[model samples]
Target chain A: MTYGLFSKFPAQPGKGDDLADFLLEAAELLERDPACIQYVVSGSDEPDVVWVFEVWTDQAAHDASSEPEDIRTLIQRAMPLIAGTPEQTQLVIHGGKGLPS
Target chain B: MTYGLFSKFPAQPGKGDDLADFLLEAAELLERDPACIQYVVSGSDEPDVVWVFEVWTDQAAHDASSEPEDIRTLIQRAMPLIAGTPEQTQLVIHGGKGLPS
Candidate 1:
């Protein structure tokens, strides 16, 4: 089963760019992980919010990625720029155009 | 440039399955649209919520899709199952694994 994650990060005043940059850089790290199917980082219409949509092979794959040093480092860098708690939704992908069918 | 959309639908009590089914069926309709780069419909951890993540070639493609009769019909079918106002985020895809580079 594919594990999908949708998360919203509201950046602190004037810190939106910083958060976006951090996420873009983190995408590189995720790309190297075979378990990562898709990791899209986007800038929303709302100036202060950044959205992350991700797909992993499974729950374990996602958990393993979080334990990596690079991801931990990036999280630390991004944490201060976030204005408030992130809103997250975890889902199971039934079928999608991008995923392996 | 790609136009991305992340929308959440919170289904009315006992209408979760109906919402999921509607979205899954809608995915098939979207597949035939060339402008739709990717459209993934998912069922979330919250029983009553469904998440839709979409990528389009551009904003015009997205707009044109909304004007179609088929899509309009689906929207009508889905409206009754929804419990509250949908939360939507529109974004510009800077770079993503699933999108064409």
Candidate 2:
């Protein structure tokens, strides 16, 4: 699978929860899009952090979902909610098994 | 740039820090590897939850990193630390800006 995960901290300590909510909402929106095979958004207890994990059939599908103008808004709104910039990674996902079982 | 993000849960509570440590160590080791461009590991306030964000020059480099046996160990050791299976994702980073300040 073409998979990757990343996390971000809100610019302020208290903003984490809000940011988490925002990202979750974004996930709901993104999942509805046909290009998104699977996407999940979650928050950290830190109240200033959030995470994103996503998978796509291929790069083209992933890139297509990323082009909408609303996508930009979703991130800009999340900017201040972040402390530093988000840490991003591209993973091979070698040893993963059943999810949420 | 080719990028994606994914997160994993350790199958148990109170193991988030441990998973985070293991992942960070993995990152350190991975960063030293020739194929890796940028890899960051982080933990959530909720124990047993960890996130990974990675970037690579392309699919070949990422696939190369995914083929290691150690990668499986890095995840297997994290199993008990998680509550269940970790959710994974593939993303097209649209509005991400700077990394650490």
Candidate 3:
């Protein structure tokens, strides 16, 4: 199954540029790893916000990537840059037939 | 339960601003309604990306909102600005005790 997570970060004053750079690095790290099947990083087109769409090959892979202490710390480091608290949800990737693969 | 949708739009060079404004207006419409419990809008800190985090009161409400013709058109209009296709997943709002209400 494709495990998914949606995390949001609010705009923090002048840290917009810094936060963006930090997320780019994070996405690169995940994309470079073999376990990551579909990892997308995005933000609002107009406002100060960040959202990450993550899909791993399976539960085991998702669990492994999230278990790392470094990733945890990276999130912690990025928190303060947010204007509002982040909210997220996870799910089983049921299916997407017509959409791009 | 919170129904979510994560859509990614491939950046269309100059159309970024138009897309962002469109999304903001859409969010405002949703937020003004009572069924929407939690609605968050944010963009990537670095790239041309838009992500929305939405939590509706229930499945019925979520279904109702998306059934509208105008919303569909809005999304269709915004698609061109996306750098890539969007992806998302939904789940039951199991529970969050420690988190603020």
Candidate 4:
């Protein structure tokens, strides 16, 4: 089963770009991991908010993807730019384009 | 530039499956359209809410996709099962795996 996570980040005022850039870097880190299916970063009309949608081979793949030292460092750097706790929802992917059929 | 939409639909009690099925049907409508990049339907740990994350070649592509009669019918069918006004956020896709380089 494909596992996904949808997250909303409320960045500190004027820090949306900074936060999004950090996430793009994070996405790059996962680029080589075959178990990481999707890691999309998005910016919204709401200036202080950013969104990330990720799909993995399964829940375990997602859990292990964040264990790398570099990813941990990125998360540590990203925390200070966030205004509040990020919202996350775990997902079970039903089906879609860009996914294995 | 790629355009994206992230939506949250809260379904009436036990209507989650119905709403998700409708959205999956909706996804099928766009399968042949080259401009439709990704249309992922997801069920979450929150039993009553469904998440839809869509990416298009541009916002116009997404808008035009819903103009077809069948898609409109699906939307009409889906509306009643939803508990309230759905939340939609317009997105600017930054980049990621499974997206065009």
Count of clashes, each model: 0, 34, 15, 0
Off by over 4 Å in 4: none
Candidate 1 backbone collisions, by pair: none
Chain A only TM-scores, each candidate in turn = 0.92, 0.71, 0.70, 0.94
In candidate 3, how many Å is residue A101 off? 6.8
Q: By descending DockQ, how would the candidates be arranged?
A: 4, 1, 2, 3
Residue-wise C-alpha lDDT for candidate 1, range A1-101, written one tens digit per residue:
88999888899998887898888888888878888888888887788888888898897898888788879988987889999999988989877665656
For model 3, the superposed segments whose C-alpha errors exceed 4 Å read A69-73, A97-101, B1-101
Q: Taking the tens digit of each residue's C-alpha lDDT, what string does model 2 give over A34-87?
A: 555445454433445566655555456766775678877887887777778677
Candidate 3 local Cα displacement, residue A12, angstroms: 1.4
> Which candidate gets the maximum TM-score versus the true structure?
4
Better of 1 and 3 by TM-score: 1
Error of 4 at A94 (Å): 1.0
- Return model 1's CA RMSD, one decimal: 2.2
The number of the candidate with the highest lDDT is: 4
Chain B superposition TM-score per model: 0.89, 0.69, 0.66, 0.93
User: DockQ for all models, in order?
Assistant: 0.66, 0.04, 0.04, 0.78
The CA lDDT of each predicted structure is: 0.84, 0.55, 0.58, 0.90
As for TM-score, the candidate ahead, 3 or 4, is 4
